[model samples]
Target: MTGDLILYTNPMSRGRIVRWMLEEAGASYETRVLDYGTTMKAPDYLKINPMGKVPAIVHKGVVVTETAAICAYLADVYAEAGLAPAIGDPLRGAYFRWLFYAAGPYEASFGDRAMGIEVPADKRAMVGYGCFADVMNTVEAAVSQGPYILGETFSAADVYLGSQIGFGLQFGMTEARPAFTAYWQRLAARPAYVRATALDDALMPKTA
Candidate 1:
């Protein structure tokens, strides 16, 4: 908890999402952007994350990988940020609900669709996401109840789900349903989100 917090990332990758979470947490950290195909696959970086993935973090000498896990971990460790609900708070259950859902079902189904892979109906149960349409519909319903995932309050869950929703819109992977549109607008209004996005944009290639 006391050591230097180091983030190994590349702006073009999922590391950008963790960057948003870091900004939202208001925690001090340093970023080391690893170039893809070179630095990222280098031995030193791979030592931090065997999979050679971006968005890995080192805090107090401990390493954490995966975007969702990093988001949840940072929110809890920096409790004063209020990115997460307290342990006994009723919203805590709902908090975990959307967070894991985004990481699990949402991403799984989206990946399947993006890759043109089809899951047979009978085998759907074995796959957490079931199907792309089901995942999108579930998200549409959830955002419809919004302003945010927790209704009246915005938390780290928004950082995860909102970013995914935004990505979906940007790539035309999902339809811009009314609820998703409004929720994304609200998320974009946050100062932290704006600042984080600006930083990422600055790092993006001119052609990108």
Candidate 2:
């Protein structure tokens, strides 16, 4: 994709995650904030994403959807930013591993619990996340050995996974485990994370 990316987002949604990714990549982009039930569904926006989701991006006329995909895309295209592992690096496998796991089992497991959806014991094996406790335990151990997911090298994978943990803890989807808290503190201190949050906060609507 060429030219400045156009990010279609809502201030109070998962779009914040993508905004953080954009900032991390030092991407040149413009934000188009969509209202909850209106502009998001308008024909123009629908053309970009039929699901009417916030956090879609248009780069050189190519549309990118899904938060994880967009984050990875930016990391790759902006290779100089060093947000991703180099292609031939053996670490690339582990890099993609945690990134997808975060969006998959990590998110679905806790999110299922938050919405009061309980899986029967026998059915747990069939589920991707298995159980919330197991999922959290795995994540905690994953970060406990880290300065970053790649162990000393901060990359885009941390951005996605760390954001999930941060949001999950903030809204009760996950517990504030020491490992998770420490990981979030490291990520939250990044200038990009701070800038993205501030930019999004400025876009939020003021309440009376």
Give me the candidate number with maximum TM-score: 2
For residue 123, what is the lDDT in candidate 2? 93
lDDT, candidate 2, 1-208, per-residue tens = 3256899999998899999998988888888899978999999999999998888988877799988898898899889999998989988998899999998998898778878888888999999999888888988888987789989888889989999988887887778888888899999999999999999999999989
The digit string of per-residue lDDT tens for model 1 on 3-98 reads: 479988888898888989989988888888888889989999899998888989999888999999999999998899999999999999999999
Error of 2 at 68 (Å): 0.4
* Clash pairs (backbone) in predicted model 1: none
lDDT of each: 0.89, 0.89
Off by over 4 Å in 2: 1-3
Per-model TM-score on C-alpha atoms = 0.95, 0.96
Deviation (Å) of 61 in candidate 2: 1.0
